[model samples]
Target: MAGNSDPLTPRAKIAVTAGKAVAAASRAAGRGSGSVIGGRVALKLDPDLLARLAQNLDVVLVSATNGKTTTTRLIAEALRAAGPVVSNALGANMPAGITSALAGSSDARYGVIEVDEKYLAGVARDTAPKCIALLNLSRDQLDRAAETRMLAEAWREGLAGSKAVIIANADDPLVVWAASSSPNVVWVAAGQMWKDDAWSCPSCGGVMQRPGDDWFCGECGFRRPTPSWALSGDHVLDPHGSAWPIHLQLPGRANKANAASSAAVAAVFGVPPQVALERMYQVQAVAGRYDVVQFQQRDLRLLLAKNPAGWLETFSLIDPPPTPVILSVNARGADGTDTSWLWDVDYTRLTGHPICVIGDRKLDLAVRLEVANQHFQVCENLDQAVQLCPPGRIEVIANYTAFQDLRRRVGN
Candidate 1:
């Protein structure tokens, strides 16, 4: 009784059974329709079960500050294009989510799972993936996660024992430092051919030499080596262009980074980089991250701004004349408990009076935007936002939940 009553004893299979039982109760209670939250509760029922169960299949672990879902999705797509590959296609990045995804797979030679940074260590212990892709780290969810440096350090320590081939994003200092720990690391970054906005050392707090596509820390002189898989383009780069010219369907220079990251992993697994790029371009948007739609006579392009960094990236994609725009903030606790970071983003750049009112914590967003006295059609929810969308090239930039809400409202 002293040693055996542990919660995670019987492992993930036991967790699965317990989860199903709890799910039945949740369905009875009319709770969430998602799998991760409750399934996570169930996953704790079995600790070692996942390791044992995962032994039969080769796995790929993909984690990033922003692009994990899109990159992993593209990686899975390329793998599928080549042959059969299984993954958590629904953007479940935690262990419980992993369990929920694994529940659906029948026969998969390769398992691609996007992992959450905080939980990666525990998950990695159980699921020693055949190849692990450590994407770049950034500041996000300061309330929940430590700084980017802390996450990178933790991840490096967590993945030590696994013999899986390591795929690292070489451009970011945090990732570069983590890659140093693994001797078998296969470094991947958008070749020194894309764009460089960062010039600060993540460590030592010094300026960096933006020499070409690569970077050099001036104070410490910690230089990131040229990545193995790289994008090929002058001003025009395929985000997935390590397999350049092959990926035509996927557009945008930022997308080239996404595609390149996926191509890197696919290449390590013997899938030609070009083939991966071709498969990636076949499907463009990863859910809400810049999905375009034809609305009435105008183009409603949905760009998801999860944080300040994402908003900055979205601004890079915006080159057209600064027209009226609507930025939606989700107030739902489910989206995230905090809505304060709206101020962190440089929303002031789109200087022209934004048709921005209030949303989500409607008062909060409107109050912030109102500092600039931007026009706002304050709505109770997304239903009202869809109604307020003006005609002609409507750019619908939103947070996580609002993106789906808007899509459903527009009937897209």
Candidate 2:
């Protein structure tokens, strides 16, 4: 029950040592994936390691169906003013990754963590974070995450038992309902573009109606929460109506929203709004999410598109016609074996572009593209695919595993 700042039990010490050894070996063997196996070993030995490592730390936990990683990165950067912050920048967000992050930086005073949505409750219980940032909820990892409404209900149940302040997206009805029961909440109108999974109210099960920028349920009176922190155009508005212009190198309107959400969290932790916004400008790439790198003697910009919502947001940032884009997809376990979500995305958006589809799921993507009337070709090899694209600055968009593969291949 000791806090993370407290001295670890002798057994926990041994566990940490052993875990680090395993992590080192994994790295030596070219199989290291952040703290994946190492943290698992540590937790297996001390079962209560996360709680122990989280002791005495000002922890901020972030969870969402999308943007958790980038948001976490932005929050972590903002927390730097506090000195020596612990965070799992490696993109491993389950219990193991969190455990590794806390265990390695047991002396740190602050922690910023990205948590998988399905495991948020347990992680929250273990870390007893000072604040929990809830981003928009949508259909994702259908095989593992089940239903979005159920996840929202679970989040509602979990926050009801915690004292952590909830910083949530007010535009997401699901997020609003999830944090409704929490006594202390900071709402931000960070925007939500995908509504396919939120037609019915989570609380009343009644069809929700959207008029203007807000939604209300006629049957049960459920509605979008009034936002105290709002993102309007290129500015973030405070509760008092003071606006801070946000200029981020990260592309897309979603990144601006992510900055607004992170700024809200920073404010809760006593970080000045201006200071938080300034810190966010320092982040150019988050685990290869929006970094441009060289591959096959061509400049390729990497964009990670995992689901329908993700694809929709990422596609919007691509430059208009005459820009060639390479689409890569894989049905690996990390990418969620269900490639059916391919049909859910509005591929018609790529109608005029010359699309090069490649990956384990290239055939599936090709079929989808063909139906969408997109101009396309299938190239199994990424290098060859790059060669096929038009000369300057190629845009590469990929699903989970394919994106990781590209990052590894390009040395990002």
Candidate 3:
């Protein structure tokens, strides 16, 4: 076991080696995904090592239905802006993954991570981070995550008495409602998610109606106040209108919500407000998320379509070229044991273009696209799809496993 030896034991070496190989494969496939072999192997060698390792870090953990990776990257960048920081790098958010990230660090005073909701409770208990961040809950991975309500309850229960400072996004009624259970919570706010339609009073299950962008409960008239640290219409600010500019590198209206959330969390570690904003601008899209590529003189938005919400977001970003667009799905068990989820995603965004669908499961992707009332073509493989895609501009929408396949076909 690696436990009987120094930091770089045989198990640790094997884990690190395996992680490097996995990461290399991911990179060679043209995605920037991180690996968890470091932490996984560490756990295999000695089960109780995470607690011992936790004793040496000022760890910060972030979790949410969406935006966890981008938010984690921003927090890491902000921490790095403040001082040296160690990170898992691939947004690996499990106990083993976090351990792997902290495992190989030579100089580590601080670490930041984005964890998945299902694993959050367990990981937090094991790691005992100094600061914890929670983003708003949203519909995602219904087959695995149950319901958003279930996730909110589980997260709050897991965080019940942790001494860590809780940085929570308060604009969402559900998120705010759950955070209220913890009096020690530090609320974060953003203007974009301020939709009165989505808000419901937790006390009475009555609609919480909005008045001039502020809200009040319709049933009992119990009202939750606006957030103390929210992003203003065009600028970032504290409660007192302290105008600040958060330079977010990603495009779209929703990125603002993520940028604001990251800034609020960075403040917990004493990173300057402006640096959080600046680093957001420095934050580029991670691989397979909203990655754009230029192939054969054509502009391609190579995005990963996972759960329904994630697919909806991609549809919003993809301005389907006047020419046919390439949409691909993978059927490998590792990619997603089942590919039936393609039916749930809204494909209305594929309008106005003849879509080119490609993958091992070409029929499935084509059927989904056709169901949405879009003209479509099926390709046996991405190699053929790329060839058919006009040389000037191509937008490739793909599944998780297909990301590597696409990169291999595209040669990075």
| Model 3, span 212-300: residue lDDT tens | 65666788866654576776765767656687876666765567767777777788788878877887776777754566676666667
**Candidate 2 residue-wise lDDT, 77-131, digit = tens:** 8889766788988779999878877777756778899999888999999989899
**Clash-forming residue pairs, model 2:** 3-55, 4-53, 4-55
Error of 1 at 119 (Å): 1.5
Residue 169, candidate 3: C-alpha displacement in angstroms = 2.3
Q: List the candidates' TM-scores in order.
A: 0.83, 0.97, 0.82
Q: What TM-score does prediction 2 earn? A: 0.97
lDDT score, candidate 2, position 142: 73
* Model 3 misplaced stretches (Cα beyond 4 Å): 1-34, 191-225, 320-324, 331-344
The per-model lDDT (C-alpha) reads 0.68, 0.88, 0.69
- Residue 162 miss distance in model 2 (angstroms): 1.7
